[model samples]
Target chain A: MKQRTEERMDQDLAFLLRYENIAWYEDGVVKILDRRIYPIRVEHVICKTYAEVAEAIRQMVTQSEGPYIAAAMGMVLAVQEVKDRTKETILAQSDEAAYALSHARPTTSRQMQAVVNDARQVIRDALAEGCFGQALVEAVHAYALHYLNEKYQRYTRIGQRMEELLPQRATILTQCFPGTIVGTMLRACRQKGKEVILYCAETRPYFQGARLTASVACDMGADVTVISDNMPAYVLMNKDVDVFLSASDVITRDGHVINKIGTFQIALAARYSNVPYYVTGTPDPQHRDTSQIVIEERDPRLVTESMGQKITMEGVKGYYPAFDITPPEFVSGVVTEKGVLSPYELDRYFDE
Target chain B: MKQRTEERMDQDLAFLLRYENIAWYEDGVVKILDRRIYPIRVEHVICKTYAEVAEAIRQMVTQSEGPYIAAAMGMVLAVQEVKDRTKETILAQSDEAAYALSHARPTTSRQMQAVVNDARQVIRDALAEGCFGQALVEAVHAYALHYLNEKYQRYTRIGQRMEELLPQRATILTQCFPGTIVGTMLRACRQKGKEVILYCAETRPYFQGARLTASVACDMGADVTVISDNMPAYVLMNKDVDVFLSASDVITRDGHVINKIGTFQIALAARYSNVPYYVTGTPDPQHRDTSQIVIEERDPRLVTESMGQKITMEGVKGYYPAFDITPPEFVSGVVTEKGVLSPYELDRYFDE
Candidate 1:
């Protein structure tokens, strides 16, 4: 009771040591729980095909890039079951997976591209080896698992790097779902016995703060304060949140990091508040070109709909830019699976 | 409803002629039945002082340019009851009313400013007469009532111009409250034996469209259909909304219109959809330059707070930008009490 900071540090360290490997199989069946109804309702869906996957993605069930990438891998694997695991099947699956993933979350391009790249590699290896049946299936399975694990480790490394960027008891404001990286990083901080506090923005239209990230932080027991997106100026003025970490769907070669729709405003607020702001993600080759990225237009109802009884309609139309691009200048750093790099260092990974 | 087009024409004409003078006064203490708990708990508050008025205005109990202007007038009148109606009182009342009014809704500036203008005018008239006591009281009352009446007329004229522009049954998409103008216009059209249909946009965060404007339209018995703000593009692309009419907060001398945060995007959408769009409001005189129009910000929690069982803190923050400016280029015309002025004509009114 006397040592609140030490208590929090211990709790976070415990979460870091814990292994949460359920490997919930995607199976082309959209099995991710609908995040829109999280905490209130945990509903899992099975998306059988790429089309269904697209619908789920658009609907925001499996919204995070990690799960989205994982789902694409599952769908690619499902394609093998339907047809012979030929080179054509593998290549076609990669292409289809990429498209499906891109459409799932239009703002971020890396997840889809990353998963498809792994799938294509499996195809290339299989074609060169002249393998079929069990051998081909085994190779695909290994590749899928490898990509997912690689993503996790990249997040872990980024998390470690994030810890180094800030001090032991740094107050942090996080926007959007940073996913495995966030958990791993918080776990890392807890392990290091750091007294870090996360002031999370409850990303509006979708309260990812209260619904997803907050719940996760609560589970891991972090000193987390959930605030609305608009209150960043207040937080910066009142609370001394030392650092800001956000997750991105795409980090363009030009270093235009497209994350959640409200991230740019938060970054602007942070920069104004003199808080360091950073975006964390594994940048893919496809994400190197910002022009190639197509910003997804969300359903206007997402902006118009509210939680109410009798299902009242809000008569005013709303514009939901699913993600906003933060120019490299606003971003303090870009954390990837490889390492945490400054905005200027974006080119090194882009060329990778 | 035989001869559907004729019936619609009859309804539209009635909106212009018969419905302009429906007056609604607060029954002492009024509760803005929470939009989230509709058809369930009807929450009402007895608005006693300027603070109550401010709270109501900030919380959106008295929303829309008409009711907002009316509410501001009421707030000034209520504040005057306690203090001497001097220049300080007038400025303080206007300042507080404008502050609260600005926070009540975002993207509309005319209502608050209009009320402030009315308040300022009363103060000036009060000073000139060298009258204190009952005459001063009467002057305040007269000015407040006059502003409300003036707003009603301006809206009615706008509605009339809208009918002339569209002719047939018009489907109108409204953002927030346009006050009695919209309601009166619908009534006017019906009175003229014209038919018109209204489509309401569920203005998000506050649901001004679904809760306020829809109720007003429905009560007036206008043929109204409600749609989500998100679905406007689809609705405009598919359905036939002849013209789009949104209430603006600030209309600059250069004729830039500011409205709810999302109105700009909708204007862009309307332009793309090839539907004529109009921004309605009276020209503010105090601020000769649009830049001089003070933009008000509100609590941010409102955006995150869902309409349901109360959770989290007693009040999450709510970000309410009382009004946004819309540039003249996207606006087809400006609707005011004087007349429906072409966008180019806005300068004539501001020239004074």
Candidate 2:
């Protein structure tokens, strides 16, 4: 059976929070991180330990939070299966698992932080509830899985609420990866059987659109066309792209989003064309409120150097600015793990 | 016989000054205006009457005064070849011819203006020398040819002197069609047997470098590479191009040279690389003293439109700025009809 949009959103969120192995395993099925080729294939590369799970993520075998965290949860379950009885041994193993898995890729640190925090919380909560040994382990596993499902339910609620904010069959232009947050939202729309067409930007330096997001939309069965960054302003000027949606690597507490450099120009064009633009990111205290957030400065040589199977020499100096900060005023809305927050509702999103 | 740099400069300058047919009769060969290959290649058009000459010029069938003016000289001679008593008819025909020719192309009005002015002057000079009828026609034709040849000689001298200023075997990056101007300057150096490799920019909106200048340089046996304008700054920043040469469409009496937009950027890069930049143009009264000169704005849609042959239904707008003004300070020297003028010699190039 084809997974409806609501089903995908539920699956993504549930997958993000769950850790137990199930007898009913599916291959060529949908996963969160690598959205491009999901549902069509549900093949699972099972690993027996946390180290093994870290290796999968380091190799980018499992990509987005939905799959990545799901894989992380599997690692936690693997640790529990072979873990020592003593608290010190378990704590040490948990730290090792979290550090190894977190550094596997440049990811939303919040995902790993949240999962590790939850694992620790489950242990404490189980002990406080007078659960111990095998019972404690069973309770923790069940709680982790339940939390994952709860996040999925929240996504559905958010997606349903956002539907009222969006028109039927809206045309959207997306930059970078929108994560499972917007994916869930879109999935929710799909469950309702809404039609949408996505114009994807072939984001440069790293072709996130070409490599990641385009396929995610494609997997979700949204109409998608990938174009170069230089072509966006022209497209925005001529085509009737109604909405602009993008994922943010960093969002400050005050609601400022730091995204790709050309994103600002795209936002400028969208503003000129009267298109609504949105940015989404997961929020956590460790992820720094607005002031402590730092933008990444990459090597300028990356711009001049061509990235192909083999390196080629280009006889010109190139200037590459990686990130641009979009003013909150220009943003239409902000989506978070908690909910889809309005650009003006920073206080609400970060209130906790 | 191999022409010396001095003789070539003189011939080129003389070619710039006179109408083509007379110049052709005196030199025994027609100088072709290759720029007329635009829109379509129509008649293997030649000018025999001043009216026909101006119209050909107005139509840009004859382009670039350095050569077309010589051809126009030939046309004046052709008119003279007609019945001696019909000289009055030729004179009348020439004015009407010039007026019609002036409307052919937009911008760069100097070439046609030179033709009309020289034809009328030759007529007046002939009538003044007590020459009448056939003698008057012959006198006018001979005088026009001599005038053209002398102008070419003077320009050749300027080119020769400019050659000494540049190193032999240098790599040069140049903007726009300097063929009749600094292009002739480089040809003068070739007459001296200097080796130079030219990196020519593909000036857009009109692919002047790709279509006109590159072919001219190649035809004249200059070592040349045509690259798009987008590629130059990087190439210059990394590649060891020794010099930059650009020709301006307008030079105000104050000495600012206005040429293609990216010229300024090219100049900036050349300066950063410690390479000398040169601007060349004919210093004419109609180019006007600074107070009266007007810089024409080319279409901006050229920037907004797609350059490739195939059209896509979706894409963003592009920006195309036709010309940019280069401050005299950034230019090492300006080559004109008379001599190579330094920025400080603005008063000398024009005495307005």
Candidate 3:
């Protein structure tokens, strides 16, 4: 009965929301869907080694939760490369690969580190059981596939919980590309015959919201409109926005939600207008407060130019801080797989 | 002595801030500096008739205070075209020109209407005084030049008053192209040997901040950095932003400010962070409240594309409202030619 239900949920997801479509390891190579040119053109960046996969993450070929999955597949590549070597050599090389993949981007490093560390532990257990050479590689590869499936299942449940918290008819405002969870939530809304209007803020310096989120929502047959990052406050004040939802890169233990650069401004406007703001993600106990979160400042040229065409003058510098922190006061709740928890009551998430 | 001081101020202005550089009437043609491709390429859109000038305004060849001057020059073109005809014909044509120029764009219609009306009134007086043909054309032409000079002088005073309110050494955050007023304020700071760091939000859909404001500020020798519109709240929170300044399209008698779409978000963030928000513009007694303000919804294609390239998937819609409103409670003060006054105390301006 559980297997049938899981298969039904998998069939309901949008094309880009599926695990195999985002990134997959097969035939000793990893292929990641290139998000930069997605929806315009369907393509993938082929990675023969774990180093190539790490480079792809740094280049932002895939973003949001896409990187976390790519990091796990990268560890599988690392195991495949040295399957004929001794166990000690394979473990040392895999540790190096894990470090490189986690350090690809600073803002999402916490999740990426967790994914790679779990993969390495699986490899260690398989080797201690007297599995050598190709058998050990097979063991890690199987572990990676299972890890991806478990994450998808967890998010599916979170999506159903999120849909329950929403109204029967809702006008939603969101920022950045929220990845699979939003797609699953939209699918859940359709399943229940609920009406939803989505407004997406076109995240700048990387048109992630415009390119990634809009495409997925459009494929799911949801009513969606793309807005520039600056329009969130205007839309919240003038339009009938039932809720402001977003996916966070990391939520600190103190309940500060950090996501894209524009999320904080939206949270402020949402709070002022009495609209509740909710973020979907689990809390990172490593970050006790926002002070520990490292915001990645990408290349200023990305902000200064659009499609390789310079928007501003030659000498004027551009500032592009990849993310911003929204204090707990602005957040109404954090939706987790367990349930919707209050921002101040995050400790409830770890009680189990 | 007053004339010498005015000349010194003109010399101190940046090239783009000068009246002639923005828009001017010469050789029976009105040349408007094309703001859409400014700083990247210094070019002008030539208007051979009043109709062409009005069309230029609609197309956004010039913006902010630039349109006010363009509308005045357009009236000059009308007078010259019919100077050889009957007085009745000339007056009729001038009135028609005034209506067309003012109605070019809705948001700034009040200012444009006042400018063209003032020009027509000057023509009525010139004709009544027996000035005819070339003499009548010359009379209206001279009025336009004097009117432009008076406006420059008025904004110069507003700039000086704004400088007085700012700290000696401070960091300032601004949105959209503030036009000549910001240029003059920076000059005033330089004259006083005060340090200032300016952060410009690269306002999207038009990039008025990136292409226009940053160019002008850099030319004036101020320390300036261009950031995407989404980065304002982050900068306000993390950086030492002492003041948040912007230029408004119109301010209602109830103290509501209507400006670029992103201004309200910045104001909300500024108020939250205890940074005073100041806007430079005269209040319109005509608008009783925000309900009287018309927020122009522009073409969605403008927001969906960047540099003529589509950023999102096909079939997805974009929402582009050119302006938003900031309530009086969020505003710290309104900087006018008279002085900086409390938002609630706007009636003090008309006391004289």
Q: What's the interface RMS deviation of candidate 1? A: 7.2
How well does candidate 2 score on lDDT at residue B84?
56
- The interface root-mean-square deviations, each candidate in sequence, come to 7.2, 10.8, 1.0
Query: Model 2 Cα displacement at B286 (Å)?
Result: 5.3
Query: What level of docking quality does candidate 3 show?
Result: medium
Greater DockQ among 2 and 3 belongs to 3
Candidate 1, A1-352: lDDT as tens digits: 1122222212242221222221234343435566666656645666565566566666676566435544544544545554465667666765676567555565554555556666666666776788766566556656655555555556677888887777878888878767666677777887799877777776656677656676666667677666644345456645788888888877777678877766776676677568888788755556666777776777655554544233333333344557666778888888775667777667787464
Instruction: Summarize candidate 3's per-residue lDDT along A1-352 as a digit string, tens digits.
Output: 1333434345677778776677788888999999988877889889999999999999999988888889989998998899889888999989999999999998878778889999899889988898878888778877777777787877888888889988999888889988888888888888888888889998887888888888888888878899988889999988899999999999988899989999999999999888999899999878878887888999999988876779887778888999999999999999999999888988888897
- Pairs that clash in candidate 3: none
Candidate 2 structure quality by residue, lDDT tens digits, A1-352: 1223223224533232222321111231112233222222334556555666666665444543444455446534544654446665655666666666665544345456666666766666655566556665555456545555565565556566555456788777877655554556667777777787777665544445544565556655667666544345445655688778776666666666767655655665577568888776644445445555444444445442223211111222233445666667778887655666766566687576
**What tens digits encode model 1's per-residue C-alpha lDDT throughout B1-352?**
1123221222332221221212122433323344333323344444556566556555555444434544544544554554465656655665665566545543444445555556656656675677565556456555555655444455566666655665656677666555556766676676676777777665555556666666667666666665544345445555677778887656666677766655655565577568888777755554455666665565545554556432223222234444445567778888775667766666676554
Decreasing DockQ order of the candidates: 3, 1, 2
TM-score-sorted candidate list, best first: 3, 1, 2
What TM-score, to 2 decimals, does candidate 2 have?
0.48
Query: Least lDDT summed over 10 consecutive residues: which range in candidate 2 chain B?
Result: B305-314
lDDT score of residue A169 within candidate 2? 85
What's the lDDT for all of these models? 0.59, 0.54, 0.87
Identify the CAPRI category of the predicted complex in candidate 2.
incorrect
Q: Model 3, stretches more than 4 Å misplaced?
A: A1-9, B1-9
Give the root-mean-square deviation of each candidate in angstroms.
10.3, 12.9, 2.2
TM-score (chain B) for candidate 1 is: 0.73
Choose the strongest candidate by DockQ: 3
